[model samples]
Target: MSVWLPTAPCTPRTCAGHTGPVRGRLPATALLLAGCSLVLAGVVCVPVVMLLGRAPRDRLIRWWAYGVVRAFGVRVRVTGRPQSPEGAAHTGTLVVANHVSWLDIPLVAAVLPGRMLAKSEIRRWPVVGPLAALGGTLFVERDRLRALPTTVRDIAGALRGGSRVVVFPEGSTWCGRGPGGRFRPAVFQAAIDTEAEVRPVRIAYRTARTDGQAAGAAAFVGDDPLAASLWRVVTAAGLTAEIGVLPPIPAGTLPGRRALARAAQTAVASDSANRSAESVHH
Candidate 1:
């Protein structure tokens, strides 16, 4: 990943996945205003989401998510329709999207207000931890093998309750240097039990450059601290996220959980590979 200073001179360069010129800094006042907006969003909106019931809470959170994306000046272009049930009630809709950055949460949440499943460790994080918990996020202890069934049960129960669930089957995030990492199959069991539709989603970050996409800067990978990752996001220029919500595959159509996982993985991975190739030619 290439790190660029906000104040750096603008010039195209080829190094460490960066293919275009770094952007010049925003004016001090503009940056300050942006910062202030983010702070206010967190302070005012977070509490509001907590006080409201699930239906209204998710709506406010989703709208606030859109605001946060704009406040950071990140442009998002979504392709493909999200597979949703006609009218209202759905037996269960499982949204499975590729994970690149922490931003993936709000980007997707802005569209689907479903309960998201994240790793257990995130429960200890700063403000985000509590907000996520209150927003109905399901956390799984990925390291413990024995915990898998219980987690799957939790997801299945949520689905049986008529709530949509979003998950990153990749388990961990990666720097988008190639096709993204593979999806773990265990989570698919929840879909099988409830016979839910698995919706495969692909989010590609496109920067205005000929070399690489902006995901290189925003990816939360390796030993990079959360603060440093946040810095890279604020400083990077011409960042845009392209989210593709592919058609959903019904679990009843698949033979079993493993097959469901493979099918979803193939769809998500193929979309990611095509995006990687497209980024190179630009």
Candidate 2:
């Protein structure tokens, strides 16, 4: 298999077993409708959003993302200040995070709205595909190794243009249960080339239950149908998504792409451990 198309051991049947405090059918249906409506509204406004200046567009995008997550009845808690605040004049930032669920995309965008690094297949997905393209997502042809360099070049160009680019370096979605896939070094090359700051963010899904365990209903892993995942999320009660923005790593400080990737992976992993310890203590 191509390195770009990494797979995770997490399967919906196995890892997606925690359906914490599910809501009644009527409420779940209402939440699902509201979430889908927000998504459609975003799709319809894309053209107008594209015309707006960077700052306003980013602000609107962040607002829309927050609404969508809330519409699904998911509570959001974000910690740590973003190295580059939205709408601020800054150098290119390569925002890297560990993959957990499909919700991770919007969850991160709510805090750091940027051009996303996504699999090329997402461009073909209904509703979302068109919205993603219109929002300036950077698609990767994960199946083709020969296209790797070209993808890196495109990413570097975006960074050079002073655009924040969000990428899930894990290359696949993990269950948020343990250590995820290693940070694939390819995307880090873009940061190295552009000397962009790498902001490592950690995304975790937890239930509001007294146990405070990871929310498995949010996991979108192997062979899970999109519809099933969506229903799972809306029906799951008290699901909270947490975003932990860690310290930024200057690419110039790292000698090579691999080192840069390792540094980011360590930052995310270390934060996860610290959070887990705190959870246990509490």
Candidate 3:
């Protein structure tokens, strides 16, 4: 089914009796801020990466992602480390993760050294799309049958050339207010086709707080004004995002893409449930 998105206004709804008054930033401000940071970072790092070419470019890009996430006021809390086989850390591998929020991209990039497969529409976005492309993100157009072949081939080639690719198997962001849902299965096809090891990463988000109770919750969907939701998150004390990297599933173990995707979805779903349980108890 097509994911449902909310169409709420980005206005700052007054939360009765809140301590300090917080004003939502203008949508353009948020976008401008994020865009400026990305451009600034790129100006400095892109050159060095260019000099180093394909080899050290991955490391530079990952570092740049980390900086962008930090500058955007998003905090990433990582859990189980990605299990890389001996000498696998430096080679190309496929990193699969559950999608939780718009924040997931920067959060994942903050820690993992990899590229990402994004929707082709991102390429035309005001600032982010272009920046993403410059940073090695692969844009996929699901509707265009012809584009899939090239997308897969390019991704496979990147893996064989020793570049890790981060793909969101869920294909769409879950409702930001709750736990993660199931995966869509298509993202894992590249891992299966390329014979690349698949590493499952799960992302989780909880309300930000100080003493107790949610300081604020930011759920971006439907018509929820993107800028307003972002302001609530940015101004919140701190939001915690949990990232769990499960052990890699060997290439030949799964019979086909469907099987591989199902296995990964199951693994991520199981881990996410367990993680949620652990969070509730603590």
Q: Against the true structure, what is each candidate's TM-score?
A: 0.80, 0.92, 0.73
Q: What TM-score does structure 3 among the candidates reach?
A: 0.73
**Where does candidate 3 stray beyond 4 Å?**
1-40, 43-48, 53-59, 87-91, 126-131, 176-181, 208-218, 272-282
Error of 3 at 22 (Å): 7.3
Candidate 2 residue-wise lDDT, 50-146, digit = tens: 9999999999999999889999989888877775656643669999999989899888889899999888999999988988898889999999999
The runs of at least 3 residues in candidate 1 whose Cα sits more than 4 Å from the true structure, single-residue gaps closed, are 1-19, 25-47, 50-56, 83-89, 211-215, 271-282
- The numbered model that scores best in lDDT is 2
* Candidate 3 local lDDT, 81-173, one digit each (tens): 554766654446888876645667766766676788888888898766666677678888855656766877888888777778988766555
lDDT of each: 0.69, 0.86, 0.61
Report the number of the highest-TM-score candidate: 2
When summed lDDT is taken over every stretch of 10 residues in candidate 3, the lowest stretch is 1-10
Candidate 1 pairs with clashing backbones: 19-211
